[model samples]
Target chain A: MTINEIQDELIADFAFFDDWMAKYEYIIQLGKELPLIDAQYKKDEYLIKGCQSKVWLHADYRDGRVIFTADSDAIITKGLVGLMVRVLSNHSPQEIANSELYFVDQIGLKEHLSPTRANGLLSMIKQMKLYAITLQAKTT
Target chain B: MMEKTAVLEQFDVYGIRKDFPILTRTVNGKPLVYLDNGATTQKPLQVIDAIRHYYTELNSNVHRGVHHLSQLATDAFEVTRHQLKGFINAAHDHEIIITKGTTDSINLVASSFGSAFVKTGDEIIISAMEHHSNIVPWQLLCEDRGAVLRVVPINAAGELDMDAYRALLTDRTKLVAITYVSNSLGTVNPVREIIEAAHANGTPVLLDAAQAIQHIAIDVQALDVDFLAFSGHKMYGPTGVGVLYGKEKWLDAMPPYQGGGEMIKEVTFEKTTYNELPFKFEAGTPNIEAGISLAAAIGYIQDIGMDRIAAYEHGLLEYATARLLEIPGIRLIGTAANKSSVLSFLVDGAHPYDVGVILDKLGVAVRTGHHCTQPLMDWYGIPGTVRASIAMYNTREDIDTLAAGVQKAASMLV
Candidate 1:
């Protein structure tokens, strides 16, 4: 599925929740199901800065597509990381880089991505795009 | 015990809550349960009104100009210094130096006092439980002067190891800067004992009273502490204003922190002589509004009486500790015998930030993460703990709400 299709699916899924607690409960469940990153890549070199919680991200380029994996010490941040991975992973670098993630706001999780939140979701998005841009540069 | 209960009953926490307008507000559609007082307290209407009065009536540059507004502003600004001198019971009003805040005050002492006294091969003593504000300045001073920095270790209960601290205090010790109360742990240190131990070696001690000044009644003369620093915001005053109360001898001897208009006797091309005590440290056009407004905060506290305030907060702390302990998977950090109002804790196998976020959704505002005491966090071998620090306005109901929030968070996260 394309990034926009995945985001739309997420927004629709979140719309079913009646209250903030229900939405957060779903996110917390998603946090438990996040795809674990390679243990070797979980060092300071890959650690994203500016987060109150520690987050590590790694990218791999294969079959002319960029695959992304991430992890966070915080469950909520991990859940957000899971969403980012679902939307952006296994896509062409240009497609990934150009993707506009509006579903975050639609799903009532926009606050988690704010710079002031310090949860690293915004930084995670930036890091993912930077990876895509760099990988796209290598082919040219 | 009966007398204590009587004082707590007379305290009237709900009445005090009305004075703070922010207490009436809500967060996330629930009544705001503000437990982040250790970070910065909500200002009373008195303090807020004083700020409005300063701008509306006496908005003029202080310590200058031959106008009525200037005189009013100057008089108001100086009144805070006098109030602070009485509030902390400093030896002289001139000993109160208006600073940016506690961090700025600590940096002032570190820079000026370090330059005057600290030298190469000298040692400065600080404790493990100090906030980064109290720790970083001394580290910078030590780094600049080629001096060594020594730390007093804390026990598992987060209490300072007095035996270890005494052993660390040696002839090489140039200064001892420690916090009177731990912001993260809520451990009230034996500051009088700590001061006496340092004084035995003729070393001047600087007490970071940013946490203590609001909770405890401090008499600098009685404590015989050479330097005491605190911020106004923590005590229900406006931000950007703090007080540094130094002994007359030290204030007289130390070089000026910042060379500027008010801090200097006179400026010349050749050499500029510094001004007298308090003014020598206050360099620029000060935080005039906050300086004046701080007097209102003091008046608010004094009118209620510090003894009554302490008794009320102690009751809240006891009630909170008991309520929170009933929740399963709860681990209370800083289990010191004596503590102020801070309650730092963690749920089993749950991150502090996640718990904090959950609590926020429930309209319970708590401070999460290291509380700027990274070294202490490192010692604990945990990332951080969720800290709910109480203030005078907080009641038993607030504690119940917090306990419920924490229970909900733990059930969700753990």
Candidate 2:
């Protein structure tokens, strides 16, 4: 599916939860079953610095498509990262780079992205897009 | 949650809990058992009302205007200085200078003291377990001055090694800056002895009381400390406000922290004279509402009584330490002989962030991560620990809830 298509599914998935917290519960539900990053890929070089909790992201390309894998020390953040990977993974690098991530705001996760580095959601998204841009550059 | 315990019987915690409105609230559909007091405290109703009253009735810029409202505001603001003077038993009211918070307070002393005393090859002493607020300022000052910053080591239990501290103090030592209580470890340093030893060597000391102001009684005069700093928000007061208490001799000798409106006597094309003590360091308009409300916070503490607070908090600490230790695979950090209400611990093979997230899900708020004490965390050879710090309002029931939360989190995370 395209990034926007996956994002719509995400919004619908979270729509059942009434409160922001119920959305987190759904996120945790997603996290429990999401594909975790490989142990070898989780290292200092791959670790995102801004998160209060530790988050490691790894990306690779296959047939001009970007595949993402990630993990977090905190489950809530893990859930959020899992959601991002599901949405952005298995897509063309160009699509990942240019796609507007509207589902974050639509599902009410956008308001929760604090300016502080400790929140790390924005930083994770930025890292994913940066990976896409870098990969797209090489492919072109 | 209070039992028939003798020490707790004297303290009316339930009455004190009523003063804080946030205690009655819930987080994530469960009752909020706030254990993040070390980060910041919940404001009592009196402090909230004081800030409200400031906006509704007597809000005005202080020490600048001559109107009736301005005069009232100035007097009320000045009264808090006197309140802090009594709060910490400082020798004089002018010794208290209100600043933004503990970080700003420390920077004022560091910058001022650096200009006057610190220079190339001079040594400064600080402990290993200090908060980033205390460490970074001195590091910046030392880097700027070409001076060396020396650290006093901590033992296995996290107490400052006095022998090492004593050896570190030398004729070349300019200043000894140490925390009155460890924000990360909960180790209470013997400031009186540290001050005395520093003074014997003719070096001045500054005590970072950011963690101790609410839990223990501090006497700048009794301890004979050269300078002391603490934040208002940590002591049931508003944010963006803190007190920096310095002796008269030091304040006179040091240069001003910032050049601004209230800190100046007069400004000219060529030369500008600085304002007198207290006001000299207080350069900006200041957090007028926070300053004005701080007096109510002090009053609220006084009403509860510090002795009673110390006893009750000590008991709660003992109770919590015992309870948290009961969980299998738990390793308690900072097992100092002298400690306060902070409990920093980690479960085996589980990250602190995971534990904290689960505790948070259960409505038990805790702080996780290195707690801005990266060096201390490095000393333990871990990323961080889940920290549960207590204030006067935290009760036995809170501990029970926290224990259950940790048990659940531990089982899942592990």
Candidate 3:
């Protein structure tokens, strides 16, 4: 799916929840269901810095597209990672780099997320884009 | 609703709360319930005014001036030294050395004491539950001098293992630095027994009282501790000011930590001679405003009476502990038999950061993370805990909010 299409679907999915509690419950469920990264990819080299909880992210660039995998010790952080991977994974590296990611604001996730977590989300996105840029160089 | 115990009702918490203006502010549309006292207590109006009063009226350098303003500033600044001498019950005013904070004080001792006494093969013992402030200084000292750093272990309940500590203390040990109370765990160490045991080995002890000086009454003479360090901001005071109380003989024996203008008796291209007692240690023109306000903070705590404050906070701790345990998934860390007013816990299904976030929305401020004691977290095999530490002005109602907030958080997360 297109990044916008995926974000729209996410917004619609979140809208089904009536309250913050329900939304968080849904996120926790997503965290439980997330495809965790492989143990080898969970090394410090793939670890994303600036997260209060330890988060490991790995990217595979194949057929000019990037597939991102990640994991976190914190369930909420893991859930947030799942949301990020769903939106940007299986997309072209250039498309991932240029993605606006308005879904975060549209879903009101940034507003609800704590300041530190919000910063962590930004860091996650920046790291993903940097990975995409590095891989897009190899493609060229 | 939480029922206030009669013992707690004796304290004029309402009257006391009014002195702190920050308590009046709101967080996330609800009345602020600050439970992060272990991190740093909110500043009081008395301390605020004292800072302003210093800048407005008495703004001049201390000790070296023959001018009128200098004399006024010097007297007010020295008044805090005397107040701290009484606050910690040090034998003399010269025993107190002013520093930037608890970290700076510990660093000062580690550098000076390590140079004077610690040898290449000597050992310095510390405890497991110590804050990073107490642990890192000794580690750095050991690294610099090629000395060995030995740590005394703690049990699952967060109490220091006295037997392990006794075994670690040997004649080759130069210093035994440990926290009087654990900042993250709230476990009050048996400092007296520890001090006595170390003294038998002729090792000087330094108590990191940063977390204890505000909650408990300390008599340095009675404790016979060679050194004690604490910060002003942790006890309703301004920041950037702290005291390191050392016995006179030790201060006389140790080399100066810094070389600056005020700390010297004579300086020449040929050589420099150091000054005496406290002045020998206090290097530059210190935090003038913070120094003057430290007296106000000490006086405010003194007027309220430490015993009454300790009793009231003890009640809050007990109430909070009971209330938190009543929740289904709550598991409290640091279940020390003799604990201070610190409550560090975790919900079975929720991360501490997520719990802290939900609590903040409910206007309950708590500290969540390793709390600068990653070693302690590793000891417990947990990443961190949500700590709700209480002060004298905290009421039973605050804990009720915290408990209810945690329940709400758990329900949402689970």
Candidate 4:
């Protein structure tokens, strides 16, 4: 599926929850089920430090596509990391680099993207896009 | 203890709550249970009205013009300094130098004192749990002056290591800068003891009272502290104004911090004469509104009484500590025997950020981060902990809501 398609699917899934706690419950479950980064890749070199939490993301370029895996010390952040991975991973580097993920706002999680939020989520998205752009550059 | 309970019993918390307009607001569709008082407090109507009054009736550049408004503005601004002198029991009104806030106040002392007193081999001492504001200014001063900065370590309970602090104080120690209360830990440091220890070595002490001024009554003369610094905003006042209470002798000795309009007596192309004690440190046009509004905050606190405020907050702290511990996976980060108005903790298998987000959804506002105390977080080997700092208006109901929110967070996350 394309990035927008996956975001729509996630948005539809989130629509099932009427309460904020229920939405967070689903995110927490997703965090538990995240495809975590390899132990070796979870070092400081891959770390994106935020004021409130820390995130480690690793990207692999294979078969002309970028595959992303990530982790956060925070479960909510990890859950959001899981969502990002599901949306942007296994896509062409060029396509991944240019994609706009808007489902976060639709699902009422846009506050995490605020720079003042100082969680790893905003930087995580930036880092993901940067990785895709860098990989695209290397491929071209 | 009995006296304290009586003070708490007599405290009119709901009446005090009505004074702060922000307390009535909701956050994310829930009734806001604000516990982030350590960051900044909600200003009372008195303080708010004072700000409005300043702009409306008394708006003029102070200490500048020979006009009626200027004289009125100057009188009102100077009134706050006199109020602060009485509030902290300082020796004179001239001892209070208005700065931007606590950080600005600390920087003023660090730059001015370092220039006048510190030499190449001189040492400055600070504690492990100091906020970055307290640590960074001295670090810059030390780096600039080729001096050394020594740290006093903290124990497992987040209390300062007094023995190590004593050992660190030597002939080389020029200044002992430490917090009166740890912002992150809630541990009220033994300030009188710390001051006494530093004074024994002929070292001047600068107390970072940014966290303490609102929670505890401070008497600079009684403590014999050389310097004390605090922010107006943290004490239910407006931001952009703070107090730097220096002894007359120190204020006389150190050079001016910034060379600007009010800080000078006369300026020439060749050499300029500096102004007197407080004016020397206050260089540019000051935050007159905040400076004036700070007096209203002080007045509000005075009406309630500091001892009464401290007693009521102590009861709240004890209640919060006990109530929060009832959660199955709760681990308090700061467990000092004598702490005031702060509770830092983490839940088992759940990150502080996750817990904080969950609590926010429940309309529970808390601080979840290193709290600008990275060294303290490093001491515990944790990234950060969730901190709920209390203020005069917070109640047992607030703690109950926080406890329920944390329980829900723990259940959902862990």
Candidate 5:
């Protein structure tokens, strides 16, 4: 599915849930549906620093778009990564670079995360964007 | 749960629990069994009353006030400095500097001391079991200066390896900062021994005593520490008020942390002269109400006696640990020989968050995550652990409630 389509579905699912528990359960389910990165990509180069959860991310430039795959030891964080990947992947490197992921705020994800977890999420997104920028520079 | 009368007679746990108003609230239709004391403790009535009384009766800026109300307020505020001097057994009141919290206290030391004494190629030694507060400040300092930070590793039992700590000390090591207790693992580090070893190497040491002040007694003079930092909120006091105890000589030697109103002796357009020892570190209008309330909290703790509180909490830890160990597939973390009342564990197949959610539904509040020691968490090779840290007010009944909740959660998850 396209990024906009996934975001629409997320908004719809969020509206369907009346309570926090339901929202959390739905997020976990979304995390379960995240496509796993190939095992070969789970190397030191793709490793994220300073996260308690073992999160791996890899990005590639394919036909003017950035294709990214990610996985995590944590379910919720994996879901968080899935949310990010769904938004950023299959888009032009420039678009992915320019766009802010307001979906996190739209869904109020940071409010639910503990301070440390919120920091980890921020670090992961920052690293992913940095990698995309590096790819953008290479293509230029 | 234990028999009410017997528990009441044996220990004044009920009367003690009554002092904490937040404990009476219901979370998810049940009484809140808050076990996250190591993170931040709940304030008692005495502390709350002291804060209210300060603002209501004695409301004036300290030190410079000449009016009648100002004298009363200044005296009350300075009274806390004397109280903390007695609380930590510091040599003099001038040694105590009020800070925002332990984090600010440690940062003050790192910024001021690091700029003054730490030079390029100098080494700073810290422990593997340190909270991020202790680790990050030194890391930032080392990054700014060309100094390197060497870590004293922990053993398999979650205790600081004394051998490693000693081995890490070298001629180039300028500072050695260590936490008195491991917040994540409940390991009570041999801080005196660590200090002595560091001093032997001619290195100054700072003790992050944030976790230790509540669970154990602290004697800054006896420990021979160069500096010590602790938060009031962790010791049954109000938040935003903490004490930083440094030797008079060291405090006098180091530059002021923040350049602001209170810390200045004279401020001219060309130059500014700083104040003396404690006030040199304290800048801006202080948290006067919280400071006064903290004195009351310290008085309350003193009335109960630190020894007695330690004994009661040790009993609770023993009881809780044994009960938790009986549950199948549970791995207890931080099994140090000398430990605090923290019980951090993980079940075989359940995520720590899942365990925390189930427990919360049963009205047992626990901290689940890396506990801000992500480096230590990385060392353990787990995402996080569910932690139930005990305090003086917690009873055996509280532990029983926690055990039952964990068992129920385990059954559902497994």
Candidate 6:
């Protein structure tokens, strides 16, 4: 689904859930819908540090776009990673690199995270984009 | 909620609780339930008053002052050093050096000791339960010096495996740094045993007592730790001020951590003579007010008595632990045989962040995350845990509130 369509669906589902559990379930379902990378791509190079969860990300340049897949040991954190993948994956490395994803405000995610977790998320996004930047440099 | 006047009788219980004005504040339009003491303790009114009184009455740079205010400030600042010496029962007052906090203290030792002693193939040992502050500095130092950093693993019950620690030690082991208590797990380490073992191997030991100094009575002489580091904020004192206690001989032998005005005796075109032990390590103008205020905070705690404080907090911990265990779907993370007042747990199928949010809505405050011990979280194979760390100020009511919030969150998730 396109970013706009996914966001619209998320908003609709968010509106439908009066309870946080229902909202959380809906978000987890959104995570399940995220196109994940195959098992073969999970390598040492894809490991991200400073995460409480074991998160691995793999990216491949296909038809001039960077297709990414990520997974984590923790469900909510994995869901977060999946949400990130949905927004940034399948876009050109240059576009992914330059895109200003206002992640904190966009998904209402930071409000739910502790100060440390918020910092961790910021670091995670930076690492992901750094990977994208490396791919962009290689492509150029 | 009991009236402040009625609760005043427990005052002798360390009437230390009365010194903290923030303790009187309300959250969610209700009385605040602060159970995150392990993260940081609330500052007492005496400490706050000292800060205010210092700025209002004696605001001036210390150590180099000829004028009255500067002299008074210097006297007050240095008085804290003496107080710290007595508090920790150190051999000499000059062994105490004030730093930004425990993180800076660990970094100082890593940069100085690691530079001077640690070399290629030399091993520096640390426990698995150490905070990132204690772990990262040594890791960075090891990487730079080509030394190996070996970790002493913890058992399933969160206690450090002494056998593993003993096996890890060798003639090549130069230093062993361990936390007195795990901030995440609340495990109270046998530092005396650890220190004796390291001493037998002719290795120096650094004790990260950041979490222990508040809840337990710290006697550096009894522990015989070569070095100790603790933060003021964790012990009801103001932030930005911490103490580093080193053996006088070791402090004198080590080079100055930072090069600046206060650390030196004389300056020259090429070389400079460093100041005496503590001053040599303490460079630049220090946090004068916080340092002085910390002395008052320490005095307040002493008035209440460490023994009394420990007994009260132990009761609260047992009460909270038992009540927390009764909640269905609630899993306690750190179940060490010996622990302090910290209680870390996870509600089945619920993110710690979500549990924390619900608790906050119910006017409860608890820490939710890795607690700066990501390595511990990795060991547990979980994202994070909700930590409720009680202090002398906390009562049983606070635990009830936390239990109720967890029950509510667990039901919603399961």
Question: lDDT (0-100) at residue B401 of candidate 6?
Answer: 85
Q: Per-residue lDDT for B220-268 in model 4, tens only?
A: 9999999999999999999999999999999899999988899899899
Give candidate 5's whole-model lDDT: 0.85
Clashing pairs in 6: B14-B304, B19-B44, B19-B45, B20-B45
Q: Which candidate has the highest DockQ of all? A: 4
Per-candidate TM-scores read 0.98, 0.93, 0.94, 0.98, 0.82, 0.82
lDDT of 1 at B356: 93
Report the lDDT of model 4 for residue B37.
97
On lDDT, the candidate that comes out on top is 4
Chain B TM-score per candidate, please.
0.99, 0.98, 0.98, 0.99, 0.97, 0.96
Local accuracy of candidate 3 as per-residue lDDT tens digits, B226-291:
999999889998889998999999999999999996899999999999999899999999998999
lDDT values, one for every candidate: 0.92, 0.89, 0.88, 0.93, 0.85, 0.82
Q: Which stretches of candidate 4 lie above 4 Å from their native place?
A: none
For model 2, residues B39-86, the per-residue Cα lDDT tens digits are 999999999999999999999999989899999999999999999999
Clashing pairs in 1: none
Q: Which stretches of candidate 5 lie over 4 Å from their true place?
A: A1-72, A75-140, B1-9
**lDDT: which is higher, 4 or 6?**
4
On a 0 to 1 DockQ scale, where is model 3?
Answer: 0.45
Candidate 6 per-residue C-alpha lDDT over B1-414 given as tens digits, one digit per residue, 9 for 90 to 100: 243433334545334456567877888676788998988888877787899999999999998979999999999998999999999999999999999999999999999888889899999999888899999999999899999999999988899999999999999999999999999999999888999999999999999999999888988889888899999998999999998999987887788999997899999989899998889999999988889899988997898888777877776788789999998888898898889989999988777865776677667899988888989888988778899998888877778988988997676444
Off by over 4 Å in 3: A1-23, A43-45, A49-51, A98-122, B1-5
Model 1 off-target regions past 4 Å? none
Count of backbone clashes, every candidate in sequence: 0, 0, 0, 0, 0, 4
Docking class of 6: incorrect
Error of 2 at B400 (Å): 0.8
Tell me the lDDT of model 1 at B318.
83
Where does candidate 6 stray beyond 4 Å?
Answer: A1-110, A113-116, A119-140, B1-18, B24-31
The CAPRI classification for model 1 reads as: medium
Better of 1 and 4 by DockQ: 4
Per-model TM-score of chain A alone?
0.95, 0.91, 0.90, 0.96, 0.83, 0.74
